[model samples]
Target: MNIQMNNIHKSFGTNRVLSGVDFDLREGEVHALMGENGAGKSTLMNILIGLHARDEGIIMIDGKETYFANPKEAERSGIAFIHQELNIWPEMTVLDNLFIGKEMTNKFGWLSTKEMKALAQEQLDRLSVSLPLLSEAGACSVGQQQMIEIAKALMTRARVIVMDEPTAALTEREIQKLFEVIRALKKEGVSIVYISHRMEEIFAICDRITIMRDGRTVDTKDIPETNFDEVVRKMVGRELTERYPSRHPSPGRKVLEVKGLTRQGWFENVNFDVHEGEIVGFSGLMGSGRTEMMRSLFGLDPLDGGEVIMKGHPVRIRKPVDAVKHGIGFITEDRKDEGLILDFSIRENMALTNLFSFSNKGFISGAKEKDFVDTLIKRLQIKTQSAETAAGNLSGGNQQKVVIAKWVGIGPSLLILDEPTRGVDVGAKREIYQLMNELTERGVAIIMVSSELPEVLGMSDRIVVVHEGRIAGELTREEATQENIMTLATGGQ
Candidate 1:
């Protein structure tokens, strides 16, 4: 089947997001879509999936003009989309979630548990995923949940599948498995539209590439006919410089130290020291305890055994407030859940951790809060209509910048960022890298957790690898390599 989108145009109030955009996906081929943040990649995908009705367009399915009023209609037409955000029913079991809306039934209209389980098992097996189908969806790891979402799409017998940043949270091994499944699907003549920011993966897996900018189709090319730099240039409208900035260690006194930090099954015996002005990276595969250790350090989760030494003093951090008072800031990996209050305005979100600074006695000073937010907004170059605009309405990359601004407003001595550039585009990623360099230059100790090996190697002064709740190995910038990190991360030591 071939999916062709012709001259799509959409507008919201005064913003004309998409304009005469055209794209296509051929049978048994993986076509990648690349663009910077706010480039209408998600918008176009939403239109294709029928989440948003385009004001003008012709969508042809198998060379026949088709119109879908909703996602259900699109799904009925053999179209399915796996969004970047996992949409799973956490309270339900994996099997139930997989076949929820499209459940199998017996002649008497009773739920066919055996049939559904068998089908779900087959889907998971095809993906080489080993998680139990009876387990609650929330009990699984982020990467596992992602795979289940993919399986759900496959179960629909979707002829044209759309994957949005499918491997953003997956480990290298899991990504390899997913690539294998994609190849299998292609062999069966399924047309796939892949969306991702990882240039390496795009180059490795895509049969053809489409670049979008400002809601317009910029260019489309065969993978063999184009290079990574050319694709990035088309998406960003400019040449992208070095993604990670060079950092020189200032070597001030130790600011944050963790000794024998243990969180039972999550991580154990994690010991490291971050000195003032140094950027230390925590690199590991998914479920390798990097995020869990960071959560424990920031007092977001309980610690079974360990000690956190802050500025040469052993401190008991029982909660986030304690960590904040100890001059530590944490930017969480899930920004939507933990980083921002979506209903609030951008200024309000930015002033969350530092309300006291803008308060007089028991009441907040409106003038001071405004001044503070305005300064940070200008400094960070946050793209917003106004300071009063809702933070949730911004693009993913802008929202990430808001998260960083929220913490920096409090002026912490140590800052921890997890997957800071996970869904961010190449242009915003450069800005984030520059911001980290600026923070380090100001003598702020930084701890970064990243899944991208190139970023880890290029940004950090030292890298620490964790495997199965234990410290597998540690390497300096000079010694870190993809092979070395993988060997340690997979317990090959």
Candidate 2:
């Protein structure tokens, strides 16, 4: 299907999300959509998908103008959207998830589980997905869950598929597999609208690129005619010279230490230390126990047998509160689920970690809250209408910055970040890395758990690679190359 959107205009109250944006895609090509948070990429797609009414625009599909009244109508028009965040029901089986909302019925209108299973298996086979049909979706690995999501989209028979950050949760192996599937789909003439923060993936798979900035179309160029720097320049309207901050290596005394940390099955015998004025990176592949060990250190999960030593003293951290009191802050990996309360406002979410500081004599002071929240909002450059705006309403990149701001409010001696810049754009990513550098300069130790090797290499003073729930190897900043890190991550010395 050839889709062309001309002069797309959408507004929410006073906020003009998409202002006269134009986008087009060919029938047998993968198109990339690039923009920073709040740049109106999502709003443009939302309008196309019939989730929001366009204030003004003409949507021409296959040279015929059409209008969709709702999401079902849009789906009927052969347009399907796979959201940035995982949208599968955790309790539903993989087979059931694929056929949901578009189930096949028998002659009497009864559900046909046998047919659904066969169809789901066929779709999975097409994508080279190897996951159990009967298993619950939540039980599957992150990469497998993403595959199931794509299979669900394929089952819709969508001529045009809008995939929003589909690879944010995938591993390298899984990503290669997904790219293979995408290539196969393109061979079958499937039009894919790929939105992502990863530059390499975009250049690798996208045939055409449409860059958006500040609710307007900057330009659209063919992939062969463009490069990464040009795409980023178009997205942010400026040259981003440094991808990461220049941090002077200055290792101080050890501020945080883990002695023989062991979690029953998740991880075991993990030992690490974070020094003052240092960024220590935990690098490993998916299911390599990187996240599990961090969760244990944060007191979110049980550490069967371990010792958390802070400032040369063993700290008894039985819960998150205990960890917080001992000056430890954790930025969770799943920001939507664990980092922020969606129902709450920006002010409320930012104050969650430091409520005690804003409250006085069993009462919270509005003035104090405003002062602290306002300071952090400006400091973090969080783009929001007001502090009263709901956190869920913010774009993904801004929401990530808000999460970092919340943790920073606690004045932690050591902050642990798990996949800090996963879904953030390049501009926001550089800002975040610069922020980490400034924090380290203030004598705050940071332990970053990241799957992106480039980030691990660029930001860390020390690298610790994990394999099979154990510390695989450690490398200094001078010695850690991409190849060496991968070798260590794969259980090398």
Residue 450 of model 1: what lDDT? 93
What are the clashing pairs of model 1? none
Off by over 4 Å in 2: 105-111
Candidate 2 residue-wise lDDT, 22-67, digit = tens: 9999998999999998898888888888888999989998999977
Please state the error at residue 111 of candidate 2 in Å: 4.1
Candidate 2: give the clashing pairs.
Answer: none
Residue ranges of candidate 1 with Cα displaced over 4 Å: none
lDDT of each: 0.89, 0.89
By summed lDDT, the worst window of 10 consecutive residues in model 1 runs over 242-251
Model 2 Cα shift for residue 336 (angstroms):
0.8
> Positional deviation of 186 in candidate 2, in angstroms?
1.1
